[model samples]
Target chain A: AQSVTQLDSHVSVSEGTPVLLRCNYSSSYSPSLFWYVQHPNKGLQLLLKYTSAATLVKGINGFEAEFKKSETSFHLTKPSAHMSDAAEYFCVVSDRFSGYSTLTFGKGTMLLVSP
Target chain B: EPEVTQTPSHQVTQMGQEVILRCVPISNHLYFYWYRQILGQKVEFLVSFYNNEISEKSEIFDDQFSVERPDGSNFTLKIRSTKLEDSAMYFCASSGDYEQYFGPGTRLTVT
Candidate 1:
């Protein structure tokens, strides 16, 4: 079984400041990690993915995440937080070796940006 | 630049009524999936389809839920009888490879 846990429920940051959202996962097989963002009343948009190729992955809107196998973590980061960046972020995990391709999502971390 | 698209941005239905949420996934994609998120909850996978049939599904997708790709372009999710608890935002996603492209989602309000 695979599962994900978001470390923060809500994170508040000032505009132009750095931001971080942490996640951890547990899986029985090789795992694929992903980050998705959702605006108010909207569907999720894929931000980035880690499929064993690279530990550090960059995504759209100036967001990025690093997958650390030793730490069992995949934390999202951005150098500068924008007002438009305020949204709900989810950390998801799935196993490539498992027949069940469904994703297990973290509870989510709501980013709050202040100008 | 292609993305998944869903219809009826919002739908209001009575309890026990059937609801059909439609989607047109990115052309050339082989795998399709349906997911749902209740207010203030995590996104939950409902089903996954490939090769013109269901490849996998979550426990949440019970007898009341079914998916189909009846035509060449459109994919759909039909809830045989929606309950008030079924109200949520339903998203359709498709993947040609591993990265799934998601739709804007359809908000279903079961009253």
Candidate 2:
């Protein structure tokens, strides 16, 4: 089974400051990790993915995450937090099944940005 | 840039009613999936469809739940008899390789 745990339920940061959201996972097979963001009443948008290729993956809107196998962690970070960046962020883990893969999502960390 | 789309953004129904949620995945994508997030809960996988049939399903996808690619462009998830617990934000996602793109979810509210 593949599962992810988000370390924080809510993270508050000032605009232009750094942002960090932590996640950890466990999987029986090789895993693919992803960070998805959802704005209020909006769809889940892909921020970045870690598929065993590169340890540090950059995504849209100036967000990035690093896959650390030794720590079993994939934490999202951004140099500057924007008010528009406030959203619910989910850390997801996917493991290949018979012919496909399924996403196991974390409870989610709600990022609150203050101007 | 193509993206997934879903219909009936918000649906309210009474218990035992049947609900069919529709989705149109990104064109050229080969894999489709359904997931749900109840209020204040984590997203849970429901089922995945590939090659015109179901590839895998989670335990949450009981007999009451079914998925279909009824037409060439439309993928759907149907709940035969929805319980109160079935109320959630249902998201449809499609993937060409591994990274899946999601659609605006359908809020299924069963009263």
Top-TM-score candidate index: 2
Measured on C-alpha atoms, candidate 2 has an lDDT of 0.93
In the range B1-111, model 2's lDDT, one tens digit per residue, is 899999999999999999999999998989999999999999998999999989889899999999999888999999999999999999999988668899999999999
Model 2 docking category: medium
List model 1 lDDT by residue over A1-115, tens digit each: 9899999999999999999999999998779999999898676899988888889999999999999998999999999999999999999998873323678899999999999
Clash pairs, candidate 1, are none
Cα-based lDDT at residue A84, candidate 2: 97
Error of 1 at A114 (Å): 0.5
lDDT of each: 0.92, 0.93
Chain A vs. true chain A, TM-score per candidate?
Answer: 0.95, 0.95
- TM-score, cand. 2: 0.96
